[model samples]
Target: MKPGIRPAHRPVVFRDKAADLASPTRSTMTGDRTVTWEDGTTYPMADVEISSASHPFHTGTARVLDTVGRVERFERRYGRGEAR
Candidate 1:
């Protein structure tokens, strides 16, 4: 590795707004806020809009759209069964 050429990896706190979850991790991102972890160590806090804590996929709250109804509506409007 080149000397002093790579980006610095520092501990940062990633905060999920919706889920109110925060954790410390190594990242190159910078932030103004700071937070202390359970180990009594402080790091720059980065606010994030979404994360696994609040995400629909991880929380099992994902909404499934009904495509069958949409298909029927399209067929009725454009005629799918008849040959054009």
Candidate 2:
């Protein structure tokens, strides 16, 4: 490792706005806001839009797109033939 070239890494808190969840994790992300965890330790809080709490996969609410039906419709309208 080179000195003075590498950026400093520290612990930061990531807060998911959608899920209204917060967790302490080691990350290089920095934020102006700060929060104290349950242990009474303060760290930088970064607000995020998505997390496992709100994600479809983790919540078992994932939606599947109907691509097969769309393809069939397109083929019926335009015909599946090679164009020169």
Candidate 3:
């Protein structure tokens, strides 16, 4: 815990453009740009390509379908038998 040796943790606004979500958190990252948040307060903002709001794993929006179930459905529709 050396004084002035560690990076400073300050308020940062992480913006997820794809999800249109912005949240405030403390980080060592700094930004020259600022943005007015929903509360009408401006903070050092950083643009993120992906965040929990837009991330498939976090949002549970990942396209994960059951391939076996799909094949079964298709076979049932066309009659399950030897392929011709």
Candidate 4:
């Protein structure tokens, strides 16, 4: 990709419908859906399933699985915990 010959960067908003979040940025993605921003300008909207707003890592809502329990269960069935 050439530096100056790249695709045009236009104002866009990647919207996460599930999280009801919209991030305004510049991108080359175009969509049929248009949205009115706070500035009263309409921009292209790209609907996404997940974003930083709703992601477990960013939102700090991730589930912590119990790996210790699984390990104990495996050792009980295979008799491997004593080898260490």
Q: Write the per-residue lDDT of candidate 2 for residues 1-84, one digit (tens) a residue.
A: 777987678999999999999989998788999999899999999999999999999999999999999999999999998978
lDDT of 2 at 61: 97
Q: Which stretches of candidate 3 lie over 4 Å from their true place?
A: 65-84
lDDT of each: 0.92, 0.93, 0.90, 0.91
Model 2 misplaced regions, further than 4 Å: none
The regions of model 1 sitting more than 4 angstroms off are 81-84
Per-residue alpha-carbon lDDT of candidate 3 for residues 25-84, written as tens digits (9 for 90 to 100): 999999989988778888999999999899999888788889999999999999788868
Q: Quick one: ranking by TM-score, best first?
A: 2, 1, 4, 3
Error of 2 at 66 (Å): 1.7
**What total of clashing residue pairs does each candidate reach?**
0, 0, 0, 0
* Colliding pairs, model 4: none
The C-alpha RMSD of each candidate to the native structure, in angstroms, is 2.2, 1.6, 6.7, 2.9
Write the residue-wise lDDT of candidate 4 on 1-84 in tens digits.
668887888999899987998989999999999999989999999999998888999999999999999999998888885545
Q: Give the least accurate 10-residue stretch of model 4, judged by summed lDDT.
A: 75-84
Clashing residue pairs, candidate 1?
none
On lDDT, the candidate that comes out on top is: 2
Error of 1 at 77 (Å): 1.1
Those runs of model 4 whose alpha carbons end farther than 4 Å from true positions after fitting are 1-5, 81-84
Question: Between candidates 3 and 4, which one is better according to lDDT?
Answer: 4
Give the CA lDDT, 0 to 100, for residue 28 in model 4: 92
Of the pair 1 and 4, which is ahead by TM-score?
A: 1
Give me the overall lDDT of model 1: 0.92
